[model samples]
Target: MASSQRSRSSTLFCAFLTLLNDRLSESLIFPLLPFLLASFSNDGRIIGLLAGSYALAQFGFTPLIGALSDHYGRKPVIAGCVAGSVLGLGLFALTLSIDWASVAWVSGSSLPLGLLFLGRLIDGVSGGTAATASAVLADITPPERRAKAFGLIGVAFGLGFILGPAMGGLLGRINVMLPLLIAVAIAVLNLLLVVGVLPETHPPQARLPLPRKRDLQPFSPLARVLRDPRVRRLCSAFFLFFLGFSGFTAVLVLYFKQAFDWGPGLAGAAFLVVGVVATVVQGGLIGPLVKRLGEWRLSLAGLGFVIAGCLLIAVAAPATAKVLVFSGVALLALGTGLVTPCLRALVSRRLNDAGQGAALGSLQGLQSLAGFIGPPLAGLVYETISWKSPFWLGITLMAGVVLLVAGGLPGQAGPRAEVT
Candidate 1:
């Protein structure tokens, strides 16, 4: 019995490490984006297009990969994705090498953009890790300890964010490609670890077939999913929440630069506070808070914090006051951390079947819609009127979310977990 427990613990530990590795490699690209943009033609629209394309690709692919995981089992899907990510990162790092060896001094600034989009698309298509990992956690953990299992996964992600961006920023200062190379190495290491150490979570006997992979229109599944009232409500609330949150995040660096004339390192540090706050709140406080207040109340608390954070941003003066700006971000993180798990749990419980991969994939597809719309909207807001416009809009959205939740918006109807 003791040996069995030890093996389970070891498996969880390795899974956590793999999750961290994936997150770190994925985020390394963000800090280098502006640098890459500078090297290219300094077109804001083009940059926005590139960012949106990454989001669109993720939106388009995560669900498909996730659904596929249900039929094929988790280990194979996750390993393949990690291996593919390593290849993608290698191509990203080698972008400049192609031009470097040429006799002609032709600029190769477009390579990063192309590689980034393609890499993100592949990663999106390959992101069965979360679905598989979540299923693995469910399989290993007793029902009473499930929240703890998910919370630990959140901790892994938070810890990765805490370190990933800072490292990416520091590495960016050395050379833009350096961070990409590090990401590639980490991915390679992650693949090896998974292949050598990880055991199969979903054995052949436990496997089930997934829905047929129809090449449907982008918004079709989203619309179909949203047609269910419960999913509609959750997605509506989530969309509003992310619309606000992503908008603010998209413009945060610009706000710092414009309002305080700060540098990239400091901007990176500000976001670091966000990751820390998110980690602490989600990992340490969420379980207790959810147990005490239940999902609805906890979600309200999160929405309230988001509103407050948006208001702070709207009124922010001299954004370079690192402490103050970071304080707002911390609040944002705190609120988001409180709410996300509840939102996700609601979904998880709703769909309480062996088909976690499909459900989560659908959820991710919904989540990615924010990525497509939020950043470009924020950029437009910043360009048209003021950098603070997005914050004001976020505040308004959060206010609506709060009011809706407070009004018993979801209502005590069908199982809250089904459509999540």
Candidate 2:
């Protein structure tokens, strides 16, 4: 019994590390994306598409990977996926190093560009590590203790999320690709850590049968979740919130770089501010705020702040207006921080015990789907429509979320979660 407990503890540590790596890799690359894609093409459309590819791939593959892990067990699935991430990040770094201009049969930047997209796609394909890590936690933890265990996952994620952009922005000064290489190293380290230390928490005898055909589809469960009238409206609010958030953020760095001539350091600082605010709000302030304000009112306030932030950023200029953008970012971070957890909790409260899994699962699927679609669409609008258009679009989207959240909510529903 002691040995079994030690094994669970060891595997749980590894799982936490995997989740940290996921957040680190994501946040690290975010600020550097505009600069990275500048090598292939300076076009906003291309930049947006490249940034969106990772999420797009993640959305399509994580469900399948989770199912595979359920059937095959956790350690092998994690090891393989981390290995794939290592390959993908390495490919991207290698492609960046190549001199496509001098190489024969390269046909200009096309080959390099193709390689870059391939790298992101491959990494996205293996983006199941975080999902699998969550499964590991569930396997080792009891129902009563699972919430505390899951909170640890958030801490790991928060640390990585705040640190990644700061590191990328700061380290990027040495070389633009330095953060990318560091991300590659982290992936490799995670792979080694899993292979050497992580145990298979899902025992074979206890494992369920293979996944059904429909179960493998990432968003397949959303259909059933949305059919419930109780959650349907909240579901729409959730999807639109993410769609607007991810859409604008995908192209935000590019916007600042082009608009105000911001460099990696400045852009990274901007992301850092966002990270700090998001962490502070979601990490420390949210529970108290939710207790006092309740989810419905807090969610509406969050949406309002986001809309105002978008307006500020939309009107920001190059010189004195830099403050406006950062201010806007702080507001966005605060609002999103409040909304992310609060809104999800709002969805959860509507569902009974039997429906919890399906409801939460659909919310995640919508978040991923929004990430997949938002960036490219924002980029296209940013290029063709106007530089200020994407923020306006974000404003519109979030406004819709506000209306949806407030539309049918009753006064009695607001304080129910707080009392619980």
Candidate 3:
């Protein structure tokens, strides 16, 4: 019994290690943005394109990966994806250094635009990120413990962000290429570790052909999984919530730096504040809160807090408003952390084998859709109006989400509670 328990612990830890590596890739890149922009002499539109491209890849590819995981055993697909990520990051690092060798190696100069797209494409398609992690969680953890398992995943993510930006910022001061190189090394190591330690979650007998357009025609999958009205409500809630959240994230650093005349270090610190608050809320508060308030009510309350936080951002005074800005962003982070787990739990609880990945992938797809559209939209709004415009728009959208979830969720709950 003890050996069995230890084995389980080892597996969970391995899964977390991989997840942490994945998040490190995300968090480390943020602090390098200014360097990337200034060095490239890229305009704001191009910067937003870069930001949106990551999401575009994730959004475009995740569902396909999810379906593939379902059809194939999770192990091979995941391991391959991890290796792909290593290669992608390695190439990214190499590209930066290649500037010393020749301009041809960079993303866009002289080279075909197709090759430039391919770099982001590989990063997006090959990471085997959430899909693999989610499948691993499903394979390893009991249903009752899934929420806790996922919360721990969020904790890993938070810790990654906590360390990633600080490390990246410090390293970025040395050279713009430093963080990318570090990310590449970590990705390589993580790939090796995952292949060495992790077992296959799905077996070869279960493998299926990759999903086609006809198979996942949105309405077909949506109808299959979204039978429970609650699922629909949750999806709607997720859509709006992410739309607002993505818009805010897309703009916050630029807004702060411009409005307050802040440096990268200060902006990174503010990001740290968000990560700390989120870590506390998701890791520390969520499990107990779920026990007391129930997932549904907890989500609604979280939404309200998010709305209020955005409202506060709308009124914040630039430069001098550090206290208000941090406070509001902290609240926003807390609210989002609190809601995300419970809502994900709700979705996981509702789905059966037939629609599991598709459903989750759809939710992820919606979030990605937000990512694809949100940043550019925010950039446009910022250009046309003010940096503050995104926050105000987010506040309004979040308020609508709060209302929709409150009203629509109850009607959907009765049927969904039976899916499990």
Evaluate model 3: give its TM-score: 0.82
* TM-score for each predicted model, relative to the true structure: 0.82, 0.95, 0.82
Q: What is the C-alpha lDDT profile of model 1 across 84-143, one tens digit per residue?
A: 777666765665334433534444445555765676566655655666677778877889
Clashes of 2: 0
The worst-scoring run of ten residues by lDDT in candidate 3 lies at 411-420
| Clash pairs (backbone) in predicted model 1 | 347-420, 349-417, 350-417, 350-418, 351-417
- How far in Å is the alpha carbon of 58 misplaced in model 1? 2.4
Q: What is the lDDT of candidate 3?
A: 0.72
Task: Please report, in order, the local distance difference test score of every candidate based on alpha carbons.
Answer: 0.69, 0.87, 0.72
What overall lDDT, based on C-alpha atoms, would model 2 receive against the true structure?
Answer: 0.87
